[model samples]
Target: MKLPKELVNGSIIFIGITAYFLLMVILGYGNSFYLRLVNIFFVFYGVNRTIQMNVKEGQTDFVSNAVSTMVTSLIGVFLSIIGLVIYSYMQGGDDYVQSLSETFLFGGNPSIFIYSVSLLFEGIASSVIVTMLLMLYWNNRLTAD
Candidate 1:
């Protein structure tokens, strides 16, 4: 039952995402499941990377994991936002945000730049949060390994 480092991380990410996706669905956030899944992948990857940190031999490198996760999450969130915005614009600018599902799609204002920035911030924050949780798990397992 031994798993390589990469497999372990990947498995963790896959399981985590599945759990989150199911939760979102159960909680009624699954209307745009496709979009949410795409966005969540980035967070999953980033969090998985964070969980890769190993300090088993009196070693510590939590900061590196934190940074990587932050960066990855940011990228994921940004990509998701971009997809949403493009979809929104295509559906018809002012007329698009009418639906409840579309309302949750996130198009802050008329400016693309502002929307981009907002998504970027969401990415960064999400990545940081996901990574932080992974880091805690990693740290705890470090000594047990």
Candidate 2:
């Protein structure tokens, strides 16, 4: 059975993010700025591909396109977060958890549950933002005839 275009696009995004993370680990720069910056490109690529796939599949309605973009972003974010959690556990969870707490949740250490919840919210926000930006571009293209 063929996968839906949305799933295909999401998988692409997830794979790209996971590959980047692995690359960072290999290069011993897992938490570096440069590697993180590369993730922006992955997001853009995912959104672009989502648009292309939706159009190709004759699902060019704005809502359909937007849904596809959102789905793609969600999958990317979910996979990225899961990968990070695994990396943290592998590298020893305490230091990783403490760093995250200091960096994001102020000083006091947060439980893993809290940290994961925060990550989920961040992912949702990312999904919405990417979807909105892509939809704006796509809308213009659609109207530019």
Deviation (Å) of 4 in candidate 2: 1.7
What TM-score do all the candidates reach, one by one?
0.53, 0.84
**CA RMSD for every model?**
7.1, 2.3
Highest lDDT scorer: 2
Per-residue lDDT, model 1, residue 45, is 64
Writing each residue's lDDT as its tens digit, candidate 1 over 27-91 gives 88766736564646645664565444443333366676566555555544555555556655876
Candidate 2, residues 11-65, lDDT tens digits: the string is 7787888887788769888646455667767887887898987777777799878
Worst 10 residues of 1 by lDDT: 50-59
Which window of ten consecutive residues has the lowest lDDT sum in model 2? 98-107
Model 2 lDDT vs. the true structure? 0.77
What root-mean-square deviation over C-alphas does model 2 reach?
2.3
In candidate 2, position 75 carries an lDDT of: 79
Candidate 2, superposed: residue stretches over 4 Å from native: 100-106
